[model samples]
Target: SKKYHCTYCSKGFSRPSSLRIHTYSHTGERPFECPEEGCNRKFSVQSNMRRHLRVHRGGRPAR
Candidate 1:
């Protein structure tokens, strides 16, 4: 598989899209928003938002 490397953190990804998304960690861009009304939470990565949604579902915050 082709590997994409991040210029800022030296992390590697299999896809360019994944690397592009990972760049947000260094840039501090939160584009993903919680769909639940009035939550008002944003995340740079989609998985973070998924983890955050657990709080609204009565689950503990992700570690």
Candidate 2:
């Protein structure tokens, strides 16, 4: 399998797309936002947004 490495954190990914998205964490760029009507929360990763949606679903946010 091919590998992609992060220059800032030394993390490795199997896909270049994953590495590109991970770069947003280093840059502090949040392009994903909660879609709930009253929530203004934003996330640098999609998984975080999915986890955050638990709050809207009446469940605790992931710790």
Candidate 3:
């Protein structure tokens, strides 16, 4: 078992992959990209890109 610690709590995982994904809260890396034409946008996580895509699809800006 692999043990991991966070600012508020700690936990253990059977596989390192789970721990690795959980560690993203500490490292701000943009790994996901927007595929829209002429829009070279990258996001720190996949969900951010998903949210951004809606804007290009005629969604109003979050003012």
**Which regions of candidate 3 are displaced past 4 Å?**
5-28, 60-63
13-56: candidate 3 lDDT, tens digit per residue: 66666655555656755677788898999876676788898878
Candidate 2, run of 10 with poorest lDDT: 54-63
Q: Candidate 3: lDDT over CA atoms? A: 0.67
Pitting candidate 1 against candidate 3, the one with the higher TM-score is 1
Please state every model's RMSD to the true fold in angstroms: 4.1, 4.0, 6.1
Q: What is candidate 3's CA lDDT for residue 62?
A: 28
TM-score per candidate, chains pooled: 0.66, 0.68, 0.52
Candidate 1, position 50, lDDT: 88
Worst 10 residues of 1 by lDDT: 54-63
Candidate 3: C-alpha RMSD to true structure equals: 6.1
**Candidate 2: residue 8 lDDT (0-100):** 100
Q: What value does the lDDT take at residue 49 in candidate 2?
A: 94
List where candidate 1 sits over 4 angstroms from the true fold. 1-12, 60-63
How would you encode candidate 2's per-residue C-alpha lDDT over 1-63 as one tens digit per residue?
548899998899999989989899899999989998989999998888989999888787644
